[model samples]
Target: MSKDTIKCKYIFEEDYNPLYVNGAQGGINSLGEIIINFYLERNALPKSQTFSVENGKISKENIDKVEPKDLKNSFVRVFQNGVVMNYQTAKEVHKWLGKHIESLEQIIDEQKDKK
Candidate 1:
């Protein structure tokens, strides 16, 4: 058995921004496409803040105390962007991610054994 492959030159994008995402959340849209929204999980912002201003000699102070109040939320997920793909593409991505995850786990195990 033999296999044939094609080699092509790849071009790099001049302007690109790399973002760090911790989690993903999404579902199938109306068009029956898989939608995966990547997001960065972080602490929720405070509702409001209070600042204390005191008249010392000229200004209030070197560092004025600003207290954030009414912070009741635990965490928040800020969704940056999402990717939409068909069923076939979804399966391809699933296989690709599984392979990469397995490789990463093996690398981690190797590091642990070295230590």
Candidate 2:
């Protein structure tokens, strides 16, 4: 498989909609960049809103605040066969991707040694 053909399941807010996204990996040096960029792009929205007020305006100012971005809900679940992690724990799950890649490499090396 080409490096650019990494397939991953991206879950939107509250697991409402799941989309299959393909990101291009810049070889082994750029293993996790794809998912990291995806997370940033997905969650980098304007969370805070602004309002205007007039002089001594005493109207009902009950502004509704938007909920925080659910990082856990919006994350890449897997990256090809090298990365397999849960999406609930965003940071920890992505962190495990490195270890999983290393483990896969080690297993591949061991298999090659046996042959």
Per-model TM-score on C-alpha atoms: 0.72, 0.26
Cα lDDT listed for each candidate: 0.80, 0.50
Q: Which pairs, if any, clash in model 1?
A: none
Tens digits of per-residue lDDT for model 1, 8-79:
998878876778999999999999999999999998775544444557434432222222433453678998
In angstroms, the error of model 1 at 21 is: 0.7
Q: What is the per-residue lDDT of model 2 for residues 5-80, given as tens digits with 9 covering 90 to 100?
A: 7679976677465445455332223333323322112333435544556686645432444333453355443443
lDDT of model 2 at position 1: 62
Show where candidate 1 strays beyond 4 Å: 1-5, 11-13, 53-69, 72-74
RMSD in order of candidates: 4.5, 17.8
